[model samples]
Target: MSIISLDSVCKSFGALKVADAITFEVREGEALGIIGPNGAGKSTLFNLITGNIAADSGTVHFLGEDVTRQSAMQRCLNGIGRSFQIPQPFGKMTVFENLLVAGSFGQGKSERAVEQAAADILDRTGLIGRANTVADSLSLLERKRLELARALATAPRLLLLDEIAGGLTEGECSQLVGTIKDIHATGTTIIWIEHVLHALTSVVERLLVLDFGKVIAVGEPAGIMARPQVREIYLGIEV
Candidate 1:
């Protein structure tokens, strides 16, 4: 089943059109990669779907229902969990506490349920060993894991990953990709917006190329990278 769908969605900031008639669907258990130059509306599209920013026009649907009018919290509870481009964790909170908060607030589960959920999420995101570590004291990689762990605490069927691999070393990127692949193997659908083409190509089967706030190409990863238009936009940046 298609878990999420966007039809003729449009959003703008003053004169800049962020998402221009954007339309796409994410099937259950599929990982989709979105690539484009900086400011190509990738993050904005995620915001539209997650209700962080409302679209000026068109529809946002989830699990076959129109959720265009839903608020961010509503969307989170409705199986849409997103990790931001920048890690957003409470500096003073322990890694475990952050996930517990997400489980209780975002999922509306009981304290015991939240505790179990947080533990499971930490295990899945490879943060169990550092569960008691304060968020501000963690390294960049651990911080990223906590970001994903917090999202997983919501038990989302569809996960939106925004630049989670950016600013990481090649080895670090490989480890993160492996972790993400493991998560996808367990059946969570993923929509990843990343500038690291190699990391994205390694994990995603299908690719969507956004340019100037529009989808220019959508196909198999290698085929999309080979497209002349995609090459032109990235200016020969190897994928």
Candidate 2:
């Protein structure tokens, strides 16, 4: 069964329809990449799934349970986690401290649990040596790693990644892609929203193309890119 499912979902903000009768599914351990134009409503779709905003219509099912009305915190507790487009680590805190806070606050873990979880996540995200470094003192790449580590501290089954590779050097993007691949290899399902086509293509087996609040294509990475509509809407600008 699919780990996550959205059926005929619809959401509108005033006259703007951000998601219009959208439908898709993410299978267990599947890495699904989402691409779209700047205003294609990709982030809005993420918000609807995570309960940042209520959908006007349709149902959202996560791990086979209806979560259309679940609060964001509830979703997190229920195994939904996300990293934002912008990294928001606690500047004054060390990388370890930031992750500890996520485990304690977001997952309600005990002190020992938080510490252990944070340590494990830091190792998994390749930030072990820099665990004591102040978050704000890190470079942009390290900051992004901290974001992923913080989300990992929550112990999610399915992770929603919003433009995690938006702004990074080529090498940094490649490194992040490998880290994300490792995370998925450990059985965490990932849905990544990324403008960097090459990075997404390297990590994800399946792809979904969103445009103007609708799913224009869903298939293999190359197939989606080959679609005329998708190319005209997103890939054109990319090339």
Candidate 3:
């Protein structure tokens, strides 16, 4: 079943069209990878779906309900959780506090429930040791994990991840892949936009390639990656 669907969605900024009649469906419990070169409007697409920006036309459906006009917070509360490409934890807050806020606000849980959720998220994201540490003092990888953990604290049915593997070492990326796989195992639907192809491919069974706000390819990961157009345009390799 499709948990999220975009139909003929269009968005523009001034004269530049960021998304053009975009359409796709993300199945419940599916992990999808999105890849494109810079300026491909990948993040714009994420914003559109999550209601950070409204579409100029078309409709977005979440869980069989039309949500094209929903606010970002409404969509978030309705089960859309996302992590930005940049980790933006509250600098003065502790890692546990960060998750506490997300869980409390994002899920609208009780204080006790939020605290329990935050603790579990810390463990899952491998941030248990840093739970009491201030967010600003954490290393880059820890920040990324916290970003992911905060999103998980929302208890979303559909998680949108934007470039979470951007600045990790090879080993660190591998570890993140493992963490993501574990999350997927819990039946959370995921749509991840990433430049680190190996890490993205490790967790997503299907792939979508976008360029100039339009989908250029969609298929199984290996087949999509092997396509000449995808290789040339996004992968920067001749096939």
Write down the lDDT of every candidate, Cα atoms only. Answer: 0.88, 0.89, 0.92
**Which candidate should be chosen as best, given lDDT against the real structure?**
3
TM-score of 2: 0.92
Clashes of 3: 0
Candidate 1 ranges beyond 4 A from true positions:
none
Lowest summed-lDDT stretch of 10 residues in model 2? 230-239
Provide the global lDDT of candidate 1 against the true structure.
0.88
Model 3 bad stretches (over 4 Å): none
lDDT of 1 by residue, 201-238 (tens): 88998999998889898889988877787898874755
Which residue pairs clash in candidate 1? none
Question: Higher TM-score: candidate 1 or 3?
Answer: 3
How are the candidates ranked when ordered by lDDT, highest leading?
Answer: 3, 2, 1
Best by TM-score: 3
